[model samples]
Target: MEHIRNFCIIAHIDHGKSTLADRLLDMTNAISEREKMDQVLDNMDLERERGITIKSHAVQMYYKFEGKEYTLNLIDTPGHVDFSYEVSRAIAACEGALLIVDASQGIQAQTISNLYLALEHDLEIIPVLNKIDLPSANPEEVSDQIIDLIGCKREDIIPASGKTGQGVDKILEAIVKRIPAPKGDPNAPLQALIFDSVYNPYRGIEAYFKVVNGTIRKGQRVKFMATDKVYNADEIGILQLKQYPKDEISAGDVGYIVSGIKDAREVKVGDTITSADNPADAPIEGFEEVKPMVFAGVYPVEIDQYEELRSSLEKLRLNDASLTFEPESSAALGFGFRCGFLGMLHMEIVQERLDREFNMDVITTVPNVSYIAYMKKDPTVPVKVNNPADFPDPVKLDRIEEPYIKAQIISKSEYVGSIMKLCIDKRGILKNQVYLTSDRVELTFEMPLAEIVFDFYDRLKSISRGYASFDYYPIGYRESDLVKVDILINGDPVDALSALVHRSNAYDIGRKMCEKLKELIPRQQFVIAIQAAIGSKIIARETISALRKDVTAKCYGGDITRKRKLLEKQKEGKKRMKQIGSVEIPQKAFLAVLKLND
Candidate 1:
């Protein structure tokens, strides 16, 4: 264990984390330069297409220093806010972290957020400034900013270019020097932490674990503490960009365990695995379950594809433990699942995977945050409502509490006023602001997560001219003047069209939603009324005239009486159709209105 070093890389998105991982892999001779692809650590095609890391991957590298051989376990982690849960699990299984910041971008919202997480884990941090080859590189300024932000020494900060592969050897050397060896007893009960898991078509659920103590070998029965299910380790292996089967994995080694368990839910992330017979006294501490922060309804475009969609999502969820879903029915989109995700990006990635991987067309409703409502009759009793369809009558609810988040926006000084206004429009409270440097500023606010989940990021980028970066973490619930605004299409409530809105902004939001819906929904044979309401009161309304068939076209040579009879007959048919006819809401309408992010 003295020669073993386990560490992970953390940074803001698009800040050269993956590139640095590639360079390190090449430098350590773990993967040849010819064998490596761009973003080699990122295995998912969606991740490569989006230029982001959607999952965390671990690999073992062999390095030589001072004529001594050392086993280096490097875990590459995602930097996006949505994958913070992934990052946290990786950090829990590591002894140290590499805090990578862009030379030109300097410190970002997530850069600090991830740094705090590492500090909480008490991991030794190695500050590395990346992308020094850029012409706009400002390494000196960025180094000074890190010193001011995190109190790391000036001389300790290392400068490197991930693209150019400069200073990568120095980084590897620092890991061997600064990061301490794993301390565990090989004679103790076998204990391992499952940081990630993936589903295999034939081998069942393959889990990635960091051996904390003892040793695990093939054919041994292991128990997952969270599930209490014991399964024989069909195989054990190391991931060197690919799986390499092995007979045993000793203490302080990072590798994959294949248990013949087919169910994905059985092998959960953050669960502890130990010898089934010689079990540890307790599971590892400091690990918690990942809860989804955003929720949306996912319905198949073709209702008959519901079962296929369900199976596809289940398969996808096997790899993504952060994803959650349950069967849900919508008046507009038919049967589907109410899926929960960590953030908007997570939701998008899952949807894209379903489409690209499964070839299933789906319709997703607008995303929402969970709300807690107090009963009017019993003020002390609180109810957790995950769906708008579950919302009780406004009269029965005494007060509503929506999820709030502590949001941080790092941008230039000139855009501070605009960002403040944008947050205020979303009902954000100004908490504090700090000038990170003369050119850059950090603004902190207590904002409603629901408000910014969709348009906030896009709007922030627009106002800041794409110079600003944003990050947020949930900050519990707060009481608000909230109401569930329901959309009525021709006097019929559409559950999928309902949204939770603040009372003050209800009128404006309701009106805009109605108008957008009016434009999206196609005209029917009979006139359709689009109305948005708060409880029994309709706050906004729009009308779409019926598509005329022009019954008078064929009556040019007919008598006036004949034309009158034709009109009366057509009108009578229209009345009956209005009562019996249901609106056919096009698939595009839901796709266009619900998904404002493009």
Candidate 2:
């Protein structure tokens, strides 16, 4: 039998990790000549269009060097900071990591964070310098920086261009020599670590896992350690871009197993799967439950499309286990679901998919952070609140803890003063600053999560003329004086647009939010008043001017079909709004005003 080597490709966003994976597949002929595809592992449409790996994808291949065949199991991990939890899970499944660094841009914030995670796991690290084909390629300089930052040997740096397939053979050779082979007992009971799963109408729910210490076949019965549910394996296969049937997968192999599971919730990522007869001694530890950091409410524009909206969410959840939903009833907007996500990008992807894929119109509420509240002097029991409407009274809140993040920014030396001034205005605490190069500098700051959730990154890039890159990670929680500012339309709480803000900037924030709302909300048949208030005190108000005239005022009896079509269009337009008794508010209005600083 050939030796097995497992490794993961890690890098910062836009650092060419996915591209390198594709080149490796081509070099090894893992994908057939006719079956070649772009970003072969990123099968999701959203992932391909966005040019980022949102989920972890696994594939098994064979490489022959010097007449010796080696089995390579490769896992592609997400590069975005929001999916750090997923990245860690991928790292745990591998015996080593291949760190990819941009030749032009030495090292980034995410690069340092991921490198630290690999070190924590005690995985063998293979540093690779990519993008050598570019005109500004500086492999020598980047290699020096990597040696300084990560303490890796200067000779360990493999220089290559993933775009041109340069030095790809060297990377494959390193994987075989540096990463240790799997040395587990194959006769033992099946035990695997599930890193991801997906649901398909024809195939049911499929699971992707790494066989850590045993063998599994097509007909064996297995049980999930966390759920305690038994299932008969109907099929076993390796994912060659897509699932390919296999008789069995032994230890150290990355593949998928399907057992006729219909419920997506039954199979969760990070759970363990073992044989039914002789289960594992204990479930693999170190799996941290993912809590959605951002919350929002989703409803259909047309009341009759409620069922369609729910179906769309179900389809989305089939592939994405992080997206969560619970039925919610709104006093002003009727029934909907309160959805939770990892971050703003995740939330936006779901919303956009619903509209683009399912051909359904959806109205989403403003995204809010989770808050812990204490009521009636109960120190032990803490309530998690997502909406301001769900928040307790100010007096009942003994102390409020908000999430904080450590942000690192890189920019030209000339824009340092302007960037620092902006950070201070947003309540950022300077941590440290270092000169990375003659013209480049790295600045670190501790800032509230709420401040970074807005368009702060975009503003920083704009001020620096697109020469700045920023990244952040959750540090901890700190005490802050926070209050919920509720928006009212026609004297009733909208519930969808309520937000929690610092007590100091309540008035200015409310005014700016209301102004954006007025611009996004289209003029209705009747004038609609928008107001932001805190307990009977109005902080800001704006009005949407009434429609100047009817869109179809020249309808005649001879053109009944045309008139009917026009009326249908008008009614459809009206349905894309939340009506508060007599006031009409568009869906875009709620989204536009949610992040005032954005």
Candidate 3:
């Protein structure tokens, strides 16, 4: 149909993409006035709690204007830099993109980055200025910035506040006039691009895709181009901000198809679904596997909860394809999972969900960057090391390459000197700087990805008094003199507490780690010494303060049971610590020391 349009909403984090999607649905009467919902497309609890979309969601709506009916397929995309690859895949599945910019914040670094991605995909860009109802709204300046940055015409900018549903009609009209309708043959072999998928216990695997050619029906058999798996489409439906059963879906329509797929590994996010009998010749291009940048181990607070933790991870991964985990064993923790994530935000979201949603208490190790280990004698046998304890000796390392990023920061000019100092301290190289406004300036730098993976953003915010916004993208790998620092409790090396540090930062990292360990380790019955050493030389050392006295005053004839229980508990806690030979260490102490805030 000529009136059908497929598009997606793109914006920076907190720029109101989901809210705008909700308003558009309401304007089209897709949901009744009495059934109005907040962020209807953000179906996951973690997404709602974080106020950010982790996965791209799809919905269909019907709108009539000037006696013409239009079938609109609206896709909501994640705006955080951690999911940039997913955002790119979503843009590829659409014919047009609505760029939502915050009216008060002007053009942010992520806004420019996402806009560039949309432009690269050659999607028809319809710039919409959102949050115009805010007290500090500046639509005129934002419109000018959009024109200058994206080279869009001045009249192309549509100002609206998704909160109040203002100027939203203009956005719908622009979609019809500026964005071209889907061009495909409804009679040809079926070809659908699966942009997202989820797993449900009752219904199995549900995949959401957009039909580019032909038609898909409930009883039809389909095959995935990427995995070559075949299945009979048990059900077909359209998303009206909620699942609505449909007999069939034609070209340019976005909907979901459910089958008996129980394993999530079979249904990938970017896989293509086509007719089994008359499949398309080739799969849709531009889908790449997402690679996680940060790796950490998640251990349960209680040893008996191992199975529960594993089950929780499985269920969480079923809904989120980006989160990854593998079974890991530790001498101290016994059984745990080594989890991988796209970035720091992704790791935090997963951890928070495990605690709040699943009701599981977990202790996580420090996050680490992946490394490639090269041996002198066996140069061809390169080992991929995710944990610092796995790194080979210094003599075996020929060269080390670490991931780098192109970082950008927007802040007031008054804090320029402090920002510069912080960047230099992190071994960052200044790339460029520009004044966005009279008081606002943007600084670009090339820095090690590992440096900012922890709390660099938080530190920057504190120094700037919450006046700065930061964003970064992976550039490539660069050669650096990096070594693995192993921490020892008494005599035995604690693998979970080890870290990879540049040669220049070894001393500072060691000192910071010792201080954190002092605070994390409680006063012991006997004095315990913590030391960070390289080779046979000690770089940093600290002693935990000894306990003043034992609780002997509460002991009595009947209280003997309670005293014995307390002493047993204390001994049990000591046994969990890795025994180097004579020194007693606590497992919690190692975990706490690994997290160096400074």
Candidate 4:
């Protein structure tokens, strides 16, 4: 156990965490030259295409230091804020973390937040300034920032270039010397913490875990404490580039187990795995509950495939434990699931995976944040509302409270004014601001979670020329004057398109939604009236003209009255059709209306 060093790499998005991981694997001879590749831990196609780590990957490596062979288990974690849950899981299973900071970018918002998380878990922190080879890299400036952030000595910070393999040996030496080995009793009852799990069509659900005590052997009976379900460890192994089967994995080692449990709900992340006969007294604690930051409805393109969609989501959820869903039906989109996501990126990635991995055609409605409404009749009772259609009537509602978040943005000083303006326009209040350096500033704001659900991230990136990094966490709920904006197509309310909006910005958003729907909804044989309404009042309206079939074409060279009669007849037909026509809302329009700023 003394020679086993378990640690993880963490950083802001695109801060060279994966690159540094590659160099560590290369120097340690973990992977053969033929197996070397960029972002080797990231195996998913969606992760590769987006150049982001949507999932946390764990691998075991063997390193020799001073003639003594050491077992190093490194878990590579995602840097995006939406995937912070993955980072938290990795931290719970590790003894230390390598806090990677970009030399040129210095310390960003995510870096600070992730550092706080690692600190909270009492993990040893090793600050490594990455990207030292870039011409724009300012190692000295970043080193000072790291010192201030973590209170580490100047020489303790290692300056390394992940791309060129510089300081790779030094990093390995630090990991061996600074990060302590896992401490546990091999003679005690089996207590393993399951940090992650994946589904396999051929075998079953495989759960990846770290053994805190005792030994787990192949073909042994195990029980997940959370589910209280027992299964035989059909296969037990350590995770390398591939699964290396082993007879047993003892204390202080990271490994995986396959029990042939086909049901996805049978396995849960953060659950404790114990020996079925000699079970541990209690489950491991400190596992943070996942709080979803965004909500949206996901409906199948074909209504009959609802069950298939539900099954696919279950399997997907087995892989991604952060995803939460409940069965919901929409008058406009039919039966669907109301899904909760970590953020916009997480939501988009889930949508993409549903299409590519499961081949399930789905329609996603506009995303929104959860709210709480109090009834006038029962002032003490608070009703949770995620769907706008679930909102209570204004006459019966006492007040509404929306979720607020503390947003932290690190950017250049030049874009401070613009960033502040954008946040204020979204009904945000400036909470605090500080200069990390003469040219770099950290701005903090308190804003509604719903405000940032749409295009806030994109706008911030554009205004800052991609120089800013944003991170946020919920700050609970606050009273607000919010209204539900119901979208009506030809006098029929479309429940899927309805949204809760702040009363101050309701009119402008309503106008934009009406115009966007006008452009996205295909022209039908009858004229369509699109209106954005708040109860009895229609705040905005747009009309989509009918696709005309000229009945007057055959009246050419005839009497003027005949031509007029043909035109009149066509107009009467359109009016009749309009009365009976049902407007078909295209899938693209559901997403486009959310991007009003774009």
After superposition, the stretches of candidate 1 with alpha carbons farther than 4 Å from their true spots are 591-598
Candidate 4 lDDT, 57-130, residue by residue in tens: 99999999999999999999999999999899999999999999999899999999999999998999999999
Number of backbone collisions per candidate, in order?
0, 0, 0, 0
Question: In order, what is each prediction's RMSD in angstroms?
Answer: 1.7, 6.4, 5.1, 1.1
Stretch of 10 with least lDDT, candidate 2: 574-583
How would you order the candidates by TM-score, starting with the best? 4, 1, 3, 2
Q: Which ten residues in a row have the lowest lDDT in candidate 3?
A: 576-585
Candidate 2 local accuracy as lDDT?
0.82
Badly placed stretches (over 4 Å) of model 4 are 557-560
- Clashes in model 3: which pairs? none
Candidate 4 matches the true fold with a TM-score of 0.99
Q: What is the C-alpha lDDT profile of model 3 across 236-331, one tens digit per residue?
A: 999876799898998878889998888667877777899999999998775567788889989998999999999888777766777888988777
lDDT of 1: 0.88
Clashes of 3: 0
Best by lDDT: 4
Candidate order by lDDT, decreasing, is: 4, 1, 3, 2
Cα RMSD of predicted structure 2? 6.4
lDDT, each prediction: 0.88, 0.82, 0.83, 0.93
The better candidate by TM-score, 1 or 3, is: 1
TM-score of each: 0.97, 0.90, 0.90, 0.99
Which of 1 and 2 is the better model by lDDT? Answer: 1
